[model samples]
Target: MSAPETIAVAMSGGVDSSAVAALLREQGHTLVGLTLQLWNQRRLAGHEGMPESVQGRCCSIDDVYDARRVAEHLGIPYYLVNQEERFENEVVKPFVSEYLAGRTPIPCTLCNNHLKFDALLITARQIGADRIATGHYARNHYDEARGRWILSRPADRSKDQTYFLFGLTQDQLAHTLFPLGEMTKPVVRQMAADAGLALAKKPDSQEICFIPGGDYSAFLAAYLEDVGEEQPDLSGELVSTAGEVLGKHAGIHTVTVGQRKGLGLTSPNPLYVLQIHPESHAVTVGSEAELMGTELYADRLNWISIAELTEPIRVEAKIRHRHEPAWATLSPAGEGLAHVVFDEPQRAITPGQSAIFFQGDEVVGGGWIVNRNS
Candidate 1:
């Protein structure tokens, strides 16, 4: 008889991941529960406008305790690897910088790209595990005819996490497993209960693990203070679409494209933030109609299901996570860049967000949005 393959399960101390560990254990696979201590929840606590304490969020002390208990209950070896330095350098710093530069960034995607898959996979291999399984709702398979690995949407569409996972490379896809891809959230919770796991009813973490209260502006102020760096003065003029200076503003970092509230201007016709110019710190305000855009350019491209984009392809492009897939024509603009023109004008094509291309259920490729053309 063949020996069982050793698998390392990335346990986030949540029901989905805990259930994954249980499912793999029942199949007789040698399981090792692993959790990456990516951030210290108390690092910024007590700072002005920051929370006094945080619990039940990702990387909190409570999560670590829960993960350890689950490993003990499952009778498997477990390890909590500290990767705080890497997480801050790769995810947190860039997140702050992106926001300061008049862009909105998704740190979860950065964490998955740099830490969870890259660093954790290295740790898994060092421990003699052949593959690392995560609770992410996505799927991947090797296509024999194409001689490449393909990532696709999961069976549970509502729980699909392929948007943040678009940066996954072919090699990473080959070495990783998504055990919860075929299961819905309700079914996974039931599996956790059946396995006797205690956290079956635990609520999912919603906010960015590092940012408490979902207040980016407050976090930015606290983080800058912590680093002993003075906040850059980004205050300038608020202008209209016709280059008419309306009033003085505080800073560029406090606003984003398509922001309607907090402009501090009382206009009878209602105004929205149309653009943010970081160089001159000029914020342009206009009507809601000005926020619509037709074309966008994305760089830092990563291709999946194909080696590289050699020609223009018709695909559905999602500008943001909650955005519906829109019909678009994607073409190679330059080296490591893609140009997308939506059939219908899309609103708020924010920079620093990801643009994931899809053809049916398959992930064609994705990249970072640098700018958009009206």
Candidate 2:
């Protein structure tokens, strides 16, 4: 008889990951459930605008308790691995730095790339597990023909999480599993209920786990105060795209590209933020048409389907998580950079966000948006 494979399941105490544990255990796999304690919600609580209660956030103590309950129900060993310091350094600090630099950063992507997979994979191996599994809605398979592990969009397209998973390396892909990739959120919830797991109706975590109420600006203020560091000066002039100064703004940390509100100035036609200059601290505003662009440059590239991009390839590029893939031509610009020219203009191509390249459902590669030429 064959021995049951030892697998570490990253349980978030939510229905999705809990369902993953249930399914894997049913498959006769020896499970070691791990919940990474990424952040302490109570650390900065009671500070200005920060919530004391740790409800609705990921990796909360309440969540750890729920994960323990699920593991106890499954009759498996469960452990909480403290990664607060690493999470703050790799995910939280970078998020704050990018925001203060007048760029929009996706903390979820950083968390996945740095903590969840990288740190979790190391912990899984140390604990005698061969592979780690999670509930992310993304598909990965070993492509024998291409001799590379390929990541693809999951069956549940709406819940597809491959956009944030672009940083996963080939080795990481080989050692990871996504059991809930093919299942939809509704189906997973139903399965959790069928398995007699609590939290079957727990709502999906939408806000940044460490930041309560989805307020990055408030979180930044509170976080800076907590660390005993003064908030960097973000006050700058609101300028037009033609370098015409329109008005003086409070700070750059409060605004993002494509924002139309809180400009504090009246105009004949409604204006939108075109770009943010971190060095000069200038926020450019213009008409909605100015937001459209057909070309962008991406750096720090990671290729999944192919080993290296030697020549120009046709791909559908996605600038945002919800963005529909647009037909584009991708060419190598230089080392660790790619030039993407879209067939049609994309709107509000913000910097610091990911630009993922896709061919059909398979992920070709992706990189960080650096600059765009409208």
Candidate 2 local lDDT, 1-374, one digit each (tens): 13668999999998889999999998899999999999988988998888778887877788899999999999999999999999999999999998898888888888887778988889899999989999999999999999999999999999999999998999999999998788889999999999999789989877778888888888999999999999988899999988899998877888988899889979999999889988988999999999899999998899999999999999999999889999999999987889999999999999989899999999998988989789
lDDT of 1: 0.90
- The Cα error of candidate 2 at residue 59, in Å, is 1.9
Model 1, range 4-57, lDDT digits (tens) per residue? 679999988988889999999998999999999998899899999999888857
In candidate 2, stretches whose alpha carbon ends up further than 4 angstroms from where it belongs are 1-3
What lDDT does model 2 reach? 0.91
Give per-candidate clash totals: 0, 0
Shift of residue 21 alpha carbon in model 1, Å: 0.5
What are the lDDT scores of the predictions, listed in order?
0.90, 0.91
Off by over 4 Å in 1: 1-3
Listed in order, each prediction's TM-score against the native is: 0.97, 0.97
